[model samples]
Target: MPDSAGILPLPLFSSSLKRDTSRPVMLIGFQHQGNLGLGYLASTLREHGYSVLTCDFEAETSEIIESARQSKPMIVGFSLIFQFYIRKFDALMQALRAAGVDCHFTIGGHFPSLSHEETLRMLPELDSVVRFEGEMTLLELADVIGTGRDWHDLQGIAYRGTTGVVTNPMRSLVDDLDSLPYPERNFEPEKALGRKALPLLASRGCARTCSFCSIQTFYRTAPGKIVRTRKPAKVIEEMQAMHEERGISIFLFQDDDFPLFGPVWRRWAYDFVDCMHRSGLAQRVIWKINCRADAVEPEIFTAMRDAGLYLVYMGLESGNEEGLKTLHKQVSVEQNIRAVEMLKQVGLLFEFGFMMFDPGSTLESIKQNLRFLRTILNDGCAAAVFCRMLPYDGTPIKDELERAGRLLGDVCAPSYDFLDPRVSKMYNSLSQIVDVWGWIHGYRALSPQLNWAWNEVAIMERLYPGIDGLEEYRRRLAAVTKKSNDVLFSVMDNLLEVAEFDAAERWDNARLDALRREFLEELLRERDAFVEHNQSTMLRVLRAQPVQEAASA
Candidate 1:
């Protein structure tokens, strides 16, 4: 643990009150596809007569310092969602302080909320941490700071005092979500991937308590309802406003589980479609959502598609029954398969979140996952990638691993090696390949190509729907993408098998490196071919369209 003695003194809350209430309350967050958490907080703060400024993760340290200096916020709230970004946040805060930008600093979101004590100990620059749901908590804290009132008694906050760290009692969750203000719309039209996309949250919290998920733990610790949703009318109102005001034609629902609220979901779905139809935004704006496997139903998905649902991202987690049980997924492999079939039946594009390795993973479990991926791939379901299950802080898996002495690394980045040597070796090999070929190449190199294609498809669908061969072009591009992804996964599986055998025979590093490079080259070639084919086809489709349709599209 680092010493906090040399940390800078806390900014005077009294001085902050002298500033105009209209001065923005700056909130910082990571560069995710969309950060609705900060958006919600910003909107809530605005409702309470506090102005807000949101700085994304991509903002350089110098840019942040300049922004803060200009905004002159009384308090700056940092959204510490991922542990991996804590170090970056720490550096940014240090830079801000060194630059003489004095302000009260607070941190919130999953990481800080879950491990507030550790966070305070690690980051001395932060004044306090807002736990669980932050809307009301942050509003109250700002009021306290503005009025120079004692903040120690505030619930849902952990702060340092003369007596040391003081953690207040937990705050109750907001019961009527409809009462809350809609999240602020801060979308940059030019920066959006050719289509102005807005992230909307229909619900908060998940019904299932997966052992490896921090969200489940965060909600469990907070009082009140586990899963709360806004009224369908309110949801539609927000969407309509964005579409009509900002020309946002795409909506991405950032819900943990889109349709897992049981009977409430069916009614909500129907009402949502009804509202969309009434508002006429359904036909104008296409959307994507995240949900669980068991929540899938053919009828519901078909209705959603008709209401302009464009994509569905499902958390399949694992295919092996034992792996599912270990993770407490509460859904069977059959359920996952059924969900895929439902999406396919509805002709909806989809993606999956799969875990190929976990704490107790063995070669047999990995093999099962491979078979599962193969099944989905051959069925032409969607692009699926497998990752190792990370035992996030405050999760059941983290607690269990710590108790068993299997957990490694500090609280910020908890990791563990597999008990099975074969699994460990295979993972090491596959990870190397993924680092070079799958992760970096796929996200950095191939993502733009895919996003461009997606944007073109959305444009054609919206502006020139009656144009010839547009649907066929979409289908062909999707097929190429699916095939390309399948080949990548197949190569990964082969590399894992080869690594497992090589480990058993104690193969030399030179031999292993050579094999890895060979596989990587093959993957790169396959990826390039697919990207080129998609790009060429997209260009052809646009060029072949009638001049008026192309101009409009």
Candidate 2:
């Protein structure tokens, strides 16, 4: 057994219920984007000889009811990763129950894993809660249920007992990730940004414990190794299978911190490149990954690019040094800049997670963050819009706020007010404008054009290499992207300036509505010009003819 030093212990019991393995199991998730956790769980259950069916959160109420009625599962497991979805999950459960498709309901995922008892109390319809690292624990539970045995002795589970709620000790982490089967992706055809895509995980667990993130708490409380990776050859073999079966060329590495975790990652990176080359999949596919700013080594990234890494996502979090420290980001602003520069040097496109507001943010710090965003925007990086830090349950930040008596609202969806009310007011005001202009207008309307342009460029680079005008086409697309981002930042700056001055007066509902309308009209006009220019450029690229051999005549 690994160290259980600071972890809490739970009551254990012996099961009295009989197991029924022949009954089907159904997994439900709000994962239109793709739920790797659910996928892994389904695969593991299937390996243990259980019939499984899945219902995405996107399914209509009628469809979900029909699926449950048809499957008549013995277990209906709900994956509740985010706390914000509790209300939705509750409504869905009520609907399913009303539909008269009764079964033993269990909930798991990040939120439920941490607050299992609270979740059970909130939704009594759920019969049990699967705790951390559920693969083996769930498998064992299935076996016990199959044999009509007692589940009280099972580790890593919290279930309603005849007396009260009974909890069990945590399970050990899976040291060898290769021991698990690849996630079941055949349930539905997956797409990302309107293109064929597959979600892949190279590793698990993050090294850094950010105050605003719950991943640290999730893994820290579990036993055994915190981070585990599959063999590079195994990873490639899975990707190769996906390529052959689904023709999926675009892959999204869903690892929390893709390139961190010490020398193990360094070795994995090298071996991954080698395996890709040996397997000959490197030239046929392009992929994206997420990592920290401090992990952006030029040499490593260059090798990654050579192995088909075209895009990267970094959690810069905050540009302000103080804000960075508050979030326990550890890395300095200089490191963030250096990371961005390294990606630029390696010719990789990147998007960033930037937090403009935090619990202790002041007006000056917000300005610093704005300046930081402008610097990155000017450098041709796409910012993932500006937002305040959310203090999630089980995160250190949430605990700190709760201890300090600053936490407010529901535990499932807690809200924190800023220390400086003016900063809060500014955020609220600017967020209103940003919601309409930046999010609805800019990102929804204009960002897709840029992504489509990049997709075209990638296709041309791979399919028609050495073709004339490729470089020119790339330059044109980059120019358009930069221009659109510039406009986005300008709008943010303008809103911030307005908020800094006449915040109370300009924040009136009627005035804000007028301002939103005006900004929307202006943004649409500017977005149209950029989209037209990009579409024309793409048409030219598509129309360009390849060099023809001399005629035989």
Model 2 lDDT tens row, 1-553: 1123211111122344223456778889877658888889989877755678888877897898899998788778888878887888888899999999677788888888888778888887887898887888777776666556666777889987788778878888888999999998755445432235778898888778899999988988788888788899999999988776666767889999885436868888889988988998887677889999988898888988888888888889998899999999999998998998888888887777878888989878887887787776674434235567888888999999999899988966688888877777777766555444533334444454455446545544553344456565556555556665665555656656665775333234455455445544554454445445555544454345222200100
Cα lDDT tens digits, model 1, 1-553, are 1123211112333433432254468999874676778888999877666779899867788898999988888789999878877888888889989988677899998889889988998898998999998998888787777656667788899988788888899989888888888887674633332346768888888878999999988888889988888888899998877765666667888888885447878788888888988888776678888988888888888888888887888889898999999899999998998888788778776777888889878778878888887777674334456678998988999999999989998866779978988777777766554443422235543323443455455555653344456555656656655654565566556756675665232334454445445544444554445445555544665466444433433
The clash count for each model shown is 0, 12
Candidate 1: TM-score?
Answer: 0.84
* Candidate 2 accuracy as lDDT: 0.73
Q: Local error of candidate 1 at 264, Å?
A: 2.4
Please report, as a residue range, the 10-residue window in candidate 2 with the lowest summed lDDT. 544-553
Q: Candidate 1, residue 458: CA error in Å? A: 6.7
Candidate achieving the largest TM-score? 2
Which ten residues in a row are the worst by lDDT in model 1? Answer: 1-10
Query: For every model shown, what is its TM-score relative to the native structure?
Result: 0.84, 0.85
How many Å off is the CA of 125 in candidate 1? 0.9
Measured with C-alpha atoms, the lDDT of residue 448 in candidate 1 is 30
